[model samples]
Target: MTLPLRILMPLLFWALGLAHAVAAEPSGKVLRVLAWPGYADPEVLQGFSQRTGARVELTVVGSDEAMRQRLLSGRGRDFDVFALNTAELQQYIDQGIARPIELQRVPNTRRQRPRFRELSAIPGLIRRVDGLTQVYGVPYTYSEMGLIYDRRQLSAPPDSLQVLWDPRWRGKVLAYAGGTHNFSLAALALGWQQPFELGERQWAPAVDKLVALRRNVLGFYSLPEESVQLFMRHKVALMYANYGLQQLHLLKAAGVDVGYVIPREGALAWLDCWAISSSTGDPELAHAWINFMLEEPASSLLVSRQGLANTVSDSVASAPQVPLRWLEPVESEERREHYWARIHSGDSPSRVLQR
Candidate 1:
């Protein structure tokens, strides 16, 4: 009852091809993700890939400006989903680069805390687009920029932002190298109530203040690990915790004695959220990525590994009892960067003011 040899051979090849196609189906599908550093750890991405048959390509951004440039490139077709602070999310939504989220597709949102569940309560989460109010982002994690001082070097925690400029601590302080946040911090120290909104008169003064800060600091750092190294190696007496509690955790884990405090001028806080790109090729896959981030492992990693407060759980380490000034759209981001470049490069106050 055996078939002819040629006929048998053709059938065998057809069956092998079918099996290979089935096995490679998942490998063919890919999901591109853009997020902040530590937001998408390798373990978390691997979990998503294991549970679903889709591969994840993750891109980690260190600064808000860098994140914006990446998303804006190629009409935002390069990434499917990205994480950004609520304050910075407005510009993307306005440019039509951000797409509305379909809540039903992301059922894991039910697991979020009540404050996050009410998206409408948040100022920048829901926006009117084409005559319809739509949800654009899902809350993920947050932290406030506070001052971290060495316990052995100081009598107690610094109570104000002015401590960063104290002459006694000159050459013994470490500060963030970012322009936007540093400008705001400088404005606050100068007694300006609206730190983010600098007037024409406030610009030169802020620049001069930052110049003084540059001379005072041991050095400027852009990453949490670098800050830790500088703080430990230089015997840094005080630091502007740009990464907030995350930096504190890193320093403590490194065996350094440090204490964190929110300055009386009010700490700048940021709420980072997950959002979809308007040019995403597969909306369903993007939604899945967002949903997966809310799961236990991904959400818990933000707290345990990154020292951030996740939307799904209560924070174990509470921020100090001080007013938290959530970041708002600055008067001009580009202008801040322009001025800060000169200040950071050791430009003189008068020379920097020439522009």
Candidate 2:
């Protein structure tokens, strides 16, 4: 589909003509795709459109939580396919929100890396639902939540997540505004390996960590672009990079000199995959969207442009040996969200955890 420019240009004009003609009289169905910003590039969507004569409606999600809200809000039938991390995918499967993908339909799974190809072996990627184990998602893009520091502010890179708590960087540090990720990060910073399974005892320390972060940071940001803008506008010395390498790329491209590091305690990461909606009108078309994403141009753009690691290529900068703890379905998302709201609103840890 990625033809040479000389060849692609003529085809582009012809495709445009065809599109205009088709606009008068539609033929193929619309495949709605729910994914992050860089996943559904205009060129890739257009390529898929030209190839199958199908229209793709892409909706970009700012966070994994937002994607969850949208999917559950509609009983999973609102969209044909959605991009979600393995953890969220599991919840969808349990709730009967996702449909099992037929291996025969998604031939691109064969083109994935050795680790990804053996989906059954990977933890959380495959799970038993209703007494039958099934594959849920097609692994697409992934990243770790590392630390970022301004080169001019820090003589050397930070070696631990504790730096974000340093009083010296008070009102100059940046942290993700989301409750779920912040809670996981606080648990990890506290040396709790099982971040997703925090008990009552773990709640106090985690809440304290979040309260401290809120007190230290000038203001928390929710999106990668927002983080970039905040860093440039403020004298940001340190940051808890929620988007990891993707944020680093955006900052550098905007001429901000920053350094990224995985702390001694390691980093929290997410493996985002494409999943079919239970309410898909055309499973074949939905499968085609996932398959198209694995192709050369789409996979390469994820690395070269967004800095996220793709399943098919090794060209991007990936810290393979660096330890990463993948996100998982937590004990109670509702409880975490409730407490997190209070923590953000300046409630004392003791008062916040009183419940």
Give the number of the best model, judged by lDDT: 1
Candidate 1 local lDDT, 59-143, one digit each (tens): 6554566676777776679888988888888989999899999999999999988778988766689988699889999999887
The 0-to-1 C-alpha lDDT of every candidate, in the order given, reads 0.80, 0.78
Candidate 1, clashing residue pairs? Answer: none
TM-score for candidate 2, please give it.
0.80
Best by the TM-score measure:
2
Native RMSD of candidate 1 (Å) = 12.2
The list of candidate 1 runs beyond 4 A from truth reads: 1-30, 49-55, 59-70, 114-123, 345-348
lDDT of 2 by residue, 193-262 (tens): 7887889788888998999888988888876778889999997999888878878888888899898888
The segments of candidate 2 whose C-alpha lies over 4 angstroms from its true place after superposition are 1-30, 53-78, 118-123, 129-132, 315-317
- Give the distance in Å from residue 121's predicted Cα in candidate 2 to where it truly belongs: 6.3
Residue 73: error of model 1 in Å? 3.7
The residue-level lDDT of candidate 1 at 254 comes to 92
Residue 283 Cα positional deviation in candidate 1, in Å, after optimal superposition: 2.8
Show the lowest summed lDDT stretch of 10 residues, model 1.
1-10
